[model samples]
Target chain A: MIGVELRKLFRRPRTWATIAVLNALPVLVAVLLQLTDLAPRPGEGPPFLSAVLTNGALFPLAALAIVLPLFLPIAVAVVAGDAVAGEAQAGTLRYLLVRPAGRTRLLVAKLLAVVAFVLVTVLVVAAVGYVVGATLFEAQPTGGTSVSGTSLSQEELAGRSLLAIGYVTVSMLGVAAFGLFFSTLTDSPLAAALGALAVLVTSSLLFTLDAASPIAPYLPTRYWLAFVDLFRDPVLWRDVVRGLALQGVYVGVLLAAAWANFTTKDVTS
Target chain B: MSAVIRTTGLVKRYGRLRAVDGIDLDVRAGDVYGFLGANGSGKTTTVRMLLGLVLPTAGEVELLGERMPRAGRRVLPRVGALVEGPAHHGHLSGRANLSLIDAAGPGGSGRTRRARIEEVLDQVGLGGIDRRPVRAYSLGMRQRLGLAAALLRRPELLVLDEPTNGLDPQGITEIRELLLELNRRGTTVFLSSHLLAEVEQLCTRVGVLDRGRLVLQDELVRLTAPTGATVVSTPEAGRVRAVLDGRVLGVDGDRVVVRGADPAEVNARLVAAGVPVSALALQRPTLEEVVLAAAGTSADRVEAPR
Candidate 1:
């Protein structure tokens, strides 16, 4: 099932198109940064390139932010949302359902496929951003300067980069689960994808409000970029734990609702 | 014989319209049972219910002796279905679509899967269709591919909703032959179509549904057998009706037609009644007539089965 799903993922033109566009955004940002006088002057132990490194983190984050509202969640929704609905629309649901594999097994296989797609997509953004950052900024031996007046060593920076990327991956998982849940609700992949994006965007908007501060921390959107704290002199585990926990809750709730609706749907349309 | 498929009071409603109203049906093991119904008469809905793809609002369904919805997983392994229109990922090659389902179970190594695929494809006359993308396949070829998928698992029961739909004459004949061959090998076949001729030629037993209700269910031969033959001799028509009894047989015009009496006996009774019968001939209702009478519509309802 995984092999089949992977083949399906690669075959879709939209999948590759999304990846290509995402990979280019950071490079474009890198080009613009190179042309402008936005960095610290050279000969300052750390040159202008190093100054951009502080901003390098933003490339992936920005890419994610822009992509999340329209592309990331939509991508997740496109793949996961089509899990059952697409097959139903294509008339293949009956064929798959008749197989020896149970419905739960089929759903799990598809859900995992969506998760795998999410992982690959997030990795693409990380790889593209890192490569572009390295090429444009020049290699720096040090990690990054911490927010609390401390500097991170080379090894520490690599660790933080990995941690940050990992956190982003986690955040994307919530999107995938939510997309899969909507996929079971409707026969249109576009509808499912858009629906998941709508939910993510709505929740994200709510998270940005000061009035929502007390409850915002509990939202999945709130934890999306929490890994930035990992680069701090003393890493803040509070936000990290809270974010991971919130994402887990979202995944659980979404998957549970999906399973419930799927098992009971009449599936005529 | 053990029933391979059975349904009791199965119902499915879409808002106010009951797409599949209360229905009770049975298909015996190794039996090629024809489900005769017009479009929107719930044939597709019923098949979806058996496959667990559609939930029923009320009643029970059992496939291969296992109750439905609960035993769905266990029963699904033994059944293969093609509901309504044949559908697949248009961008993928025919082989790829089957491979997706193949990977789902039986755990065959790549070589085993390829070999099985080849065999099924050959069986369906889709031997070279594997290399072509589904988007390029003709309607007939797609139907064949759908059948090939169903045959992949060597299922004990095959539920095909309009298996011959959208096929040319040659394609139709080929599928009919293939289905008969499969049945000969002990696979129970359950098929639904609006074509009475196809069902008459292929099925041993049949069930008729109209407006979501199973109004008639019986063997094909029994349902299509002549209600009774009419013997006409202007004056003896009424006398013939009297001899056979008005309830069992009646005179219409110059002929005596029995509603549910054997033609031979009715003829014998008329001869002994001293009615000068000018003509004595047997008339048996065709499959179309039975279906029409059951459906409560003109013979137009028998348009085409697949």
Candidate 2:
């Protein structure tokens, strides 16, 4: 079932289009940064955007930081939202259920497929950012030093980049699970996608307000940028752990609710 | 013969509306059982329950001697079905859709899967167009593809709901012949339809449903057997109508339909009166009339068969 689901996910042209569009953003940013020849001062944008101006290796981290808050999550939302509702809207749910795919198994397959989509999307963006950044920027300055003024080995840079990608993947799981829950509740893929986006937007809105301080830490979007802490000299673990724990709660609760509601659904479509 | 499908006092309710009232069915192996009903008469609902797609509010369903839902996983592989209509991804080719469904089932090697997919496509007359996107196919072609998917596993029992709903006359004939051929190969077929003529011609046995209840069920031969009225056709119909007196049920052009009269006696009476009957025949009610009478919507005022 997982094999079949993955095959379906990859076969659609829309899937590739979404990936291409996402990767294009980082390429555009690299070009603009090269043409301007003006590096952002500290704290102007995401944690690594300023650093990428001198050292091209850091651009993958910068691209992830720029997209993680909105673009990546939205891309994950679209795929996850369509996971179940798309089948229902196409009137194929009845045929699938009649095959006795077993509601639980089908739901699990869809969730895994969404997770796979998230991983692929994030990696493609990072890879594109790396190539564009390398082409446009210098690997080492004339003084033979990076912005941090410390020479890092190739192995360490590779390891940290992978960790950054892993963290981003985990953070997006909450949105994926939320999208899937909405997918089970409705037959329209567009409605499901919008519904999941509404929840994320509301969470982000609350996170920005001082009045929402009491509930801010629990919001799904609160610690999304914690991946930045990975590139810090000592690697801060405080908010990173919190982010993982909070995402765990979201994934657990939302997936449980999705399964409970979907198992007993009438499947009239 | 062993029963292929048996339902005991099955019921399903959506809030206060009882979609399927308590109904018992016995579909024996090797018989083509036509489940007949009007548009909203609960035929689709019952088919859903039997396939474990919808849980019944009350009662039990047994398929191939095993309880449903609990045994759905164990039993579904042996059963192939096309519920409501052909539901598939519009963007996928006909071959791709079948391959996906076949892969979702329990066990099949890649070689076997490919061979079976090709074989069923050929059987359904979709040989060369297997690679075409399903969205480009016509409604009749989709119906054929649906049938092809159902046959991919060479299932022991085949269930189809209104398989010929939107088909033209030629397409309908093609489906009827395919179903008959499959049945001849020892597949037990259970189908639902509102078309009385289709069922009368294709099914050996039938169960008629009306407004969430089973009104009548019997062998097709017994149900359509001559049981009421004798029709007498003659050029002198105006004269024959007078002799038959109150026995005449109604006058239909040149034919005088009479009730409770033997064909020989009616012939003698008409000839003796110099009516010169050209044709004297017993009137066997058609399946359509039987269904309408059972549904209590008959306009011709035919007597209900006991």
Candidate 3:
């Protein structure tokens, strides 16, 4: 069932369009960095934007940072939002339910499909960023010097990149789950995607307010940037662990609600 | 024979409106049960309940000898259905849609899935167009594809709601013949329709519903058999009316409808009275009449024949 869902996902022109648009962001950033020949000052822009100007190998991390705030989540939202509601709108949900896939199993497959979409989009951005970074940015003068002045091996770089990509994937799960839950509530895919995005916007808004300090620890978007911690020299696990835990809670609660609602739905469509 | 589908006091209420009121239905194995009702008469709602698509507010549904919404996983594998209309991904080809649905079913190895899809597509007269996207299909072609999907699993019982809807006359006839052939091969069919003529021609047994209530349920032959009156048309209408006396149900133009009298007896009396009958025939109430009667409407409610 998941394989079928994946096939359906990849066959759509919208899926490829979304990936292309997402990859374009990193490409644009790389080209601009090369043309300007001026690195961003410290504490400006995304975390690694300035750092990548000196070491091309860190460009994947910078690309992830640039897109994570909006581009990546929006793409995730579109795919996840369309997961069930799109099928319902097309009048296919009734046939799918009647096949005895059982609502729970079908919902799980949809969630998995969204996760697969997130992985593919993230990897595409990272890959495109890597190639652009290598060609446009100057290689390290000392061959492979870390920001902290320690020499790094190829294995270490690959390991950190994998960990960083994995963290970003987990961060997007909350949005995927939110999109799926909204998908179950309505038949309009656009509404579902917007609803999920609305939640993210609200969470981000709350995170910036001093008055929302007490509730900040539980917000869905709070730990989204924690993937940057994986790139720290000492590899800080504090915010990363907290982010993972928060995402797990969001995924669990939202998916449980989705299952509860979907299994009892009348399926009038 | 054991019933393939049985429901007891099934009800589905949406807030203040009861879409499907308390009703009991029995569809025996090997019986072609025609579910009859007008639009919004709960025909679709009842079918949804039986298939576990809508949870009943108050009732029990036993499908294929297992309790529904509980054994739905096990029971649905043996039943095939097309509700309202065909619902498939318009972006996908007919073959892709069928393969996906087939993979979701309980049976069929990967090797046999292709063969089964081919057989059903051929059976439904869509053998050549399987590669076309559903978006390009006409209404009739989509309906045929819906039937092909239902037949993919070689189900023991088939439930189709308005299967011939949106079809041309030739298409309707082809579907009718196809359903009859499937029944001959031992697949019990349960279908719902508003067309009295279609049901009358296809079903062995039937249940009629009106405004969320079951009005009548019986064998098709028994329900439609002549039971009301004998119609006699004669040029000597005055003489015929005078001879018929109390047996006359009604008089319309030059014909007199007489009840509780045999055609031969009425003819003999009319001849004795010197009323030469141009036409003497028994009026077998059509299924439409029975439906109207069961619906509690007066016989004259329908438009009179010119």
Candidate 4:
């Protein structure tokens, strides 16, 4: 079941199209930085944008920051939101259920496919960022400076980049869970996708409010960008670890809810 | 023969509405059971519940002698179905769609998956079909593809709803033949359709559903059995009416319906009376008349409340 679902997801033209579209913004940023050499002042724009002008290796991390706020989450929401609702809308859900494809197994397969999409999408962003950043900017292949102004070796830089990618993937899993949960509640893929986005929008909104400070730590999107802490000289694990734990809770709870609702749903479609 | 699909007091309620109210369906092995009903008589709901797609609000569903929605994991793999109509992923070719659906469940061995897809496609009359995406298929083609998917596993029991819905007359004939052939090969068939003509031609046993209730269930032969009346066709209808006298129940055009169970006996009496009989046979009601007399008004019709 999982293999079949993965084929369906990857064979779709929309999946590749989404990935290509995701790389567009980061590539555009790299080109602009190369032509004009006007990088954002330190800590002003994206996290590593200023540093990417001197060391291309850091540009991948900069690229991750560029689309992290809104673009990547929206992409994840659309795909995950379509997971089950899309099948229902297309009238195939009934057939699958009758295939004796146990409802629980189908849901699990869909979740795995969504996770695969998140991983592939994040890795592409980082990889494309590395290529564009190297070709467009100056490169110090030996090592690069960390966010804390401490020099890090090439191996250390590579390790942190991978860690950052993994962190982004985990954050996106929370978004995917929201989309998947909503997907089970409706037959309209668009509505499910929008519903997930609504939660993210609300969470981000509350994260910025002083009155919501007490609830900030509990908000799903509050620690989404904590990957920036991975670039600290000693690797500030506080916010990064908190973000992972927070996303873990959200993914676990939302998936459990999704499984419960879907397994018992009347597949009239 | 053992029962293939059985239900006891199967009911599905949508809040205040009883979509399927207490229907006890008994479909036996090797029988082409026709489930007859109007548009809103809950036939589709019934099949959905049996296949575990919709849970029954009350009562039990047993497929192949196993309880449903619970034993579905073990029972459903042996049953194939086409509910309401056929549906498939439009972007992929028909073959691709079949392969994916077959792989989604257990018992579909990967080594034989390709051969299985080809065999079912041919059975549904798509043997010469190319790799064009199903989005480009006509309604008839799509319907055929749906049947192909249902037959991919060679299930022991086939549950089909309006199987010939989108087909042309010839296409309909082809599917009926295919279904009958499958039935002949030891596979039980539970056919749910509103088209009386289609069911009359294909089913051995019939059940009529009226407003979520099974109004009639019996052998088609018995329900449409000889009405104990002999129909006589002759040019001199008046002479036959006068000759039969009290036995002549009614006369229409050149035909007369007289009270007699045996056509041979009626013919001898007509011959002795010097009446020329063109055609004489024992009368039997059409399936349509039997159903209309047994079932209530069409569920789709709504009359103003007093």
Give candidate 3 misplaced runs (Cα > 4 Å). Answer: A141-151, B269-274, B296-306
lDDT (Cα atoms) of all candidates against the true structure: 0.76, 0.87, 0.88, 0.93
Docking model 2 quality class: medium
- Enumerate clash totals for all models, in the order shown: 5, 0, 0, 0
Model 3 C-alpha lDDT per residue in residues A23-105, reported as the tens digit of each score = 88888888888889787886698877888888888888889999999999999998999999999998888888888778888
State which docking tier applies to candidate 3: medium
In order of appearance, the predictions have TM-scores of 0.85, 0.94, 0.94, 0.98
Q: Ten consecutive residues with minimal summed lDDT in candidate 3 chain B? A: B295-304
Steric clash pairs (candidate 4): none
Which candidate number has the best lDDT?
A: 4
Compared with the true structure, what per-residue lDDT tens digits does model 4 show for residues A45-155?
989998888999898889989999998999999999999999999999999888978999999999999999999999999999988878888889788998899999999
The candidate with the higher DockQ, 1 or 2, is: 2
Task: Give model 1's TM-score versus the native structure.
Answer: 0.85
What are the candidates' individual DockQ scores? 0.46, 0.73, 0.72, 0.83
Q: B32-131, model 2: which lDDT tens digit per residue?
A: 9999988777899999999988889999999999999789888888898999989888889999999998887574456798899989989888888847
iRMS of candidate 3, one decimal? 1.2
Q: Clashing pairs in model 1?
A: A143-A153, B194-B305, B195-B304, B195-B305, B226-B284
**In candidate 2, what are the lDDT values of residues A57-115, reduced to their tens digit?**
78888888878888888889999999999999998887777786889999999999999
Ranking by DockQ: 4, 2, 3, 1
lDDT of 1 by residue, A13-74 (tens): 77788778766755675687677846444334222233564545334444554455455666
